[model samples]
Target: MRIVRAGHLPPLLRLPDGHTKIPGVPVGPLLGIDATARFPEPELRLAPGSVLALYTDRSIERRDSDIRSDVERLQGSPALLGGGGPDDLADGLLRDVCHASPDRADDIALLLTEYAPPRR
Candidate 1:
């Protein structure tokens, strides 16, 4: 799973007041898997409403038909968000593909999520 350190969190080592008086540079880590090397702690931030899509390599293997059309058909469906979460959309897409296939011969995994900023 992708991991990120949010905000100006201090290091594990600290003083009694739980504050870093030593004015150290605060950093956040961003990580990704696949082709590039995974960053244990990446320094990147995402704005609100940002959508992160993580799909298995099999996502491009749906042959015998137009892949874009297949994806559009699922995205345009009303039941895509039945679970009240973006993750449901991925599940719905996979389910549609699996059901359409003659037999579920391959494994599929998909994750879609929207990043919402924390409310103060």
Candidate 2:
């Protein structure tokens, strides 16, 4: 799949075997600031049962926490790796990460997609 991300935050991809962080290329700049900004399209061949997660910065940002460590924790989260639907996983992530802080300054948004090949 071709995933083109053009912002400051990157996304996460979880496969049946492992998980990884998809890095976004440094595009010209954030949208609206540069109308002519061109982004690089990174592509990947996702295996069946792979789960892709796209989240906003608020999902990981905190007042006094290391984002890298939080990301690592998120990758190994049982809720993310557990057997559940996209909605369930999203809720779990939000509860485990964002909801822990009640003084968050920004809102969180998460989108999860699981890849399932067509059945014969």
Candidate 3:
């Protein structure tokens, strides 16, 4: 997959064998900010059963804590803890990470894409 960061966070990559990493995608200017800007499209090859996670900052940002720490904490989030399917992960992240408290005022968006080859 080729990813172009338009001022967005690098996607979280989780391998089927339990390896996880946040790719170092180059950050580009926000969309429409510069029409002549060319963003770098970093290519990545994902093995079968690998999962790519895309989420907004609100998913990890908190007023009482450090964002950098929160970013690293994502690896331990409920969604990435086990081998749960995307649906289960979505629910867990929304419950435990994004919606831990309804009093906060931050919109959240998360997407999980899994690459699974047909079984032999």
Highest-scoring model, TM-score? 3
Q: What TM-score, over all chains together, does every model reach?
A: 0.42, 0.80, 0.87
Predict model 1's lDDT versus the native. Answer: 0.45
Q: What CA RMSD would candidate 1 show? A: 14.4
Error of 3 at 81 (Å): 2.3
- For candidate 3, write residues 1-117 as lDDT tens digits: 898889886688888876688887898989899899999998888898888899888877877778677777886775686687788777877887855446668778899988887
Question: Top model by lDDT, which number?
Answer: 3
Q: Which order, best to worst by lDDT?
A: 3, 2, 1
How many steric overlaps are in each model, in order? 3, 0, 0
* Cα-based lDDT at residue 62, candidate 1: 50
- lDDT scores in order: 0.45, 0.73, 0.80
Q: Which stretch of 10 consecutive residues in model 1 shows the poorest summed lDDT?
A: 11-20
Model 3 reaches what TM-score against the true structure? 0.87
lDDT by residue for model 2 (46-97), tens: 8898888887777777767777766677776777877676888888888877
The 10 consecutive residues of candidate 3 with the worst lDDT sum are 98-107
